[model samples]
Target: ANNPIWLIRNGELQSFGPDKQPIGTHGGEQNPFTLHEMQLEKGDCLYLFTDGYADQFGGSKGKKFKYKQLQELLLSVHKQSADEQRRRLDETIENWKGGLEQIDDILIIGIRIL
Candidate 1:
């Protein structure tokens, strides 16, 4: 599976580094993780997150949140301050999850280029 890191700059969202799986002992053989290098300018927002956010099941139809929708959600909030972005993301997912039990661990790291 390709795991992508999300980037937002000038109100546009870009995908990068469909990197390998998570670093863990579950793999059959030990493999080095891929290295991704990118130059970021001021105002650029970068997000690294686990699949839990997208894999969560919710909404009216009780469907997975999906990556596309996550991308859009991040794009919509990337310009906000880090605290605000965190709040919005948390609120959005909570609202989306509703009363469903969380199925996986969720982790998201956001960095704003300075």
Candidate 2:
């Protein structure tokens, strides 16, 4: 997992803090994720993901899909469109998981610079 950041209107740091320290928003009650403004001139891409994708189980016999594998997969399909990237990633996960039941919610967001 990664800490999400945002940049809106004049690069204002609209981040919340508690006790003068960077804390979750809404009185430190919510962990909000945001992608304020994306800077993609062209031929650029961004991949955001949650832990469930790597925590999945199934492969050959049955094993957790490690982060390394996910990174490799992303690198392999980095050239595809956002939609295509999502499709391929989902397909890859499904194939790796085979018939294993999903353990948790999986979220993957891909933004292509176009």
RMSD to the hidden true structure, all candidates: 1.7, 8.0
Residue-wise lDDT of candidate 2 within 52-91, one digit each (tens)? Answer: 8889999997999987687667777777666787789889
Which candidate should be chosen as best, given TM-score against the real structure? 1
Ten contiguous residues minimizing lDDT sum, candidate 1: 18-27
Clashing pairs in 2: none
- Per-candidate local distance difference test: 0.86, 0.64
- Candidate 1, residues 53-98, lDDT tens digits: the string is 9999999899999999999898888888888988999999999999
